[model samples]
Target: MSINSVKGAAIVTGAAQGIGKAIAIRLAKDGYDMALNDVPGKEDLLHTLADEIISQGRKSTIIIADVTNEKSVVEMIKRTVSELGILRVMVANAGIALTIGTEFLDTRLEDFEKVLKVNLMGVFLCYREAARQMVQQGTWGRASSVNGKRESHRDEHLIFFKEKKNNHYRAAAEMKKYGITVNAYAPGYIDTPMARQALSVNENLSNEEIRQQIIQRGSSSSGLAVNLGTPEDIANFVSYLASEESKFMTGQAVSVNGGVFFG
Candidate 1:
């Protein structure tokens, strides 16, 4: 179909609010159509969110799926292509935090399973389905994806790069088959309502003490002592990766942690 949308249609899971919402909005402003997703009942504002995009002359789709389900995840990509025509970007931003007070000794096995299922498994299913759809589209691709491609022994391994999180390696590999590129954004300590709630649980400490401790811990991990990051910081980073400017950059996590986790 030649990818008719002006920018592209992106599938962003967890786009109901917070960092996910910010990323969805940023991509829309850059001219991409949106397929925003959240677990059923977690979001009720898609009508309002979609209205904002139509106002700018773009289309929006809402998909409610438990991304951890293979069947449900597969259907999401299929419908996005069938409805939106092409799914150029897949942002697997849907995640849930581990229970705050659930210590290993006190935590139920079910809770641990719940966290991993929704997090790691959800990410995998979404990436797999998106890659499958990209392959069907028959787009052009780079050298690493061509027929009978191989890297020589002399090619740099750069072992340190293996541990990073932002680059969508699995998704990108599957994308390569379909001449598509997949990337991810791994943000740190973003200022979201969810985070605020987490931060408030330690009520014994005053706000100043808590802030100082947070800064101290962040400074240790990050090279700089910069304050907690805003969701917009992550939205900006997501925009660059989703655009053509990042064509050469794939399989990279590109930390936006104010120097907390460097490349």
Candidate 2:
């Protein structure tokens, strides 16, 4: 599609790899020019993804910024509008999962803060900046986040995931007046590098063992599907949420976890 014929621009944070990369590609295929964002070191990956999007006949730009800093996020939004077009979709997918298997008592204060800073505070900044731009443009927009649901067992990192989910609801409620919708996708046991890293906390476990653990965890609840979901699964759902089809949905943390957790 030509630039004039494409859907409005979108900013997908954490677009260097895994779910973020998948979302960017899917959005490009769905015909939105993309602004891909990640931290400093992932320039190569972001550039490659941008090239792929451009090859698909859509405009793409790489914006490297730390989401935790307010100024950085502001610049990210500014650059997206300047480089791509009006900000119509913001996928606040950039996040970190640290100290995953560590006990709450053993977790350091700084470690806990780091998790919240990236997972919680980062999403807040992305949503806030994107909403500001959308409202200013006087146009309808979509902002979707990738989050995790609360589990029966406590993982320190899950706290921030829950908070991220809450942030989506609060942002959705507040941004509705401006014709902007905010929502989240809660994925369970997706086979992403991040998921592998979280499960690899035990060095003794083999890759197959870790795979089995993910499958088992995803199927723990009776009558649920047994296989782990792919990044494309979440991306497909996000495609709907980012489009006009999901106009009535907002403030919902929709579960894309193969029935592992009902929303």
Q: Which candidate leads the pack in lDDT?
A: 2
TM-score of 2: 0.89
lDDT of each: 0.63, 0.83
Per-residue C-alpha lDDT of model 2 across residues 7-86, encoded as one tens digit per residue: 88999999999999999999999989999999999999999999999988999999999999999999999998998888
The deviation in Å at residue 157 for candidate 1 is 28
Total clashes for model 1: 4
Expressed as tens digits, the lDDT of each residue in 24-60 for candidate 1 is 8888888788888888775567667777777767788
For candidate 1, give the lDDT: 0.63
Model 2, stretches more than 4 Å misplaced?
1-4, 154-162, 201-209, 215-226
Ten residues in sequence with the least summed lDDT for candidate 2: 151-160
